[model samples]
Target: MSILNSSALRPSSLILIGIPGLESYHIWFAAPLSIIYIATVLGNVMLLLAITTVLKLQKPMYIFISQLAFSDLVLSTCAVPKMLDIFWYNSREIQLSACITQMFFIHLMLVFESSILTAMSFDRYVAVCNPLRYHSILTHALIAKLSALSLLRAIVVIVPLPLLTLRLSFCSRCIAHSFCTNMAMTKISCADITVNNVYAMFVSLFLGPVDIICIALSYSLIVRLVLRLPHKDARLKTFSTCSSHISVMSALYVPFFFGTLLTLFPNRIPVHVHILVANTYLIVPPLINPLIYGLTVKEVRQSMYLLLQNCKNRIRLWASSRVWR
Candidate 1:
């Protein structure tokens, strides 16, 4: 009976490793991670407020930035706090379903964020290369369609990962990562994971370079047009507009592709190294994206300043009311 039960037993929850080799140093790891998480939340929230509340920021580029902010917020919030939990409190037992849910949302946000960045590049392309038609080309309706398409594609592409995970029975379910990933989940299973690997490759291939390729083509075209322009000031301005998006693109894709490659062929790499690369791929972009857009993009910078100033005025008014009362 014991042998039979052991063969049929499926784990109800899985253990997440904070950092495998450095388990004793998890508290130290939490310090920087917590600080980054706080910054990401504050920065992205401020960006969202700046874009949504400011009338002048309702333009295509800012709108796309807001969408990107939302994705960053979701992605960071879904994974980072849980990681902090594992690091600070040793609270690493995640229910199987919850782990899968986290994995699903993390990948969903990644795909959606990539889609928004690609769309923003196109926004820049139209604005720089075909300045006259920018308004007609990027109507709010078009933005809505693009956003919907991005979301739908993310859902369709990522829904399979968790489902594939769910089908596999796990006797030993200690996952060697802070957050649940499809790769990490599959690694612990004794069952054949060929289907999962192939599907992962399919998802990766379909979702990965496609965004980079689109972004590259859009920028290349924009550069071509900018060079042909007669005015030096106009070229400089064009380059300025493209720079923010490029910074964001680099923030995401560089570490992302490197991490993905490591995840796919994770043989020689140390487990701790794999966890570090994965954590960096998710956390670094969120920390930097808001700062990149806020400082570099003039409209977002000015709008966020005004938004924060307005909040301060309201806070002062409230304080005065309390004092008078």
Candidate 2:
């Protein structure tokens, strides 16, 4: 009887109102999103493999980039599948615990990736602005230390999310979007979310502004140095190298900043718009980041092609061995 009653009490629909009046948009969202999900995963996986196998990409820049690719990979994997599930199957019913879990990882990855980008920006500044001092400043030990710190920062800052979420019992388990996002999930909690709200807002303001400002400042100094170069060709080379990173930074940050602002005023903006924009914040970077580097960096692309050829040859050898066996 108790089991029956508990089962009966569960929310029937995952969506609050089932995707608004945009029924037509479901096809648009589904088809493209599925492609994006596949491409993001495949692209990042290949990049990871290439980084691991190729000796040339073993430097600090590639190490940081591999970390960036990895972070974006996880970020997309966590957020995109749930979205597709929601859109395709109408499986909106996520439990409270699962919601909290998703929120934790999602936020953790976001902060960690942002920190990695900051590190990468600083790396660029050192490599270009102070080329003579670059190697000594960005030693292997220093890179390793920075990597550890980035991981630690992510763990520490994200610890509060799960702990605080555990304290608050949810009233309704129906998340508007596909995934259980920190800001969206918190809004639906019946308990006084004063602590969670304040902490989230604080983290956003502090971490976000500091990262953006620091990155901008790094680029500003780098720009000045690049301009001081006597040869126009040398100046262009410096700018060209940084262009890919700059493009990625802009794409990743702009949507995220806008989405954060929208969350602050959730009531005014229609829920679907909020959800789509928020989803975009998670989606676009993962899809385009690899392409940016692959197209811009000649060596990375060549290495990636070589890695694929090696994979094909290995498969062929395995097949021949299997036939002989």
Tell me the whole-model lDDT of each prediction, alpha carbons only: 0.88, 0.80
How do the residues 47-116 of candidate 1 rate in per-residue lDDT, one tens digit apiece? 9999999899999888899999999999999999899999899988888889999999999999999999
TM-score of each candidate structure, all chains considered together: 0.95, 0.90
> How many clashing residue pairs appear in each of the predictions shown?
0, 1
Candidate 1 error regions (>4 Å): 1-8
Q: How accurate is candidate 1 locally (lDDT)?
A: 0.88
The TM-score of candidate 1 is: 0.95
lDDT of candidate 2 over 1-325, digit per residue (tens): 0111222233332333235556446756877899999999988988888888888888888898899899989899887787787677656555566666778888888999889889999999998988899889999899999999999998999899889867665455555565776666666566779998899888889988999999999999999988899999999999998998898888889999998888778679888787777778788998888898878888889988998899899999999999999
Candidate 1 local lDDT, residue 79: 98
What residue runs in model 2 are displaced by over 4 Å at the alpha carbon?
1-24, 315-325
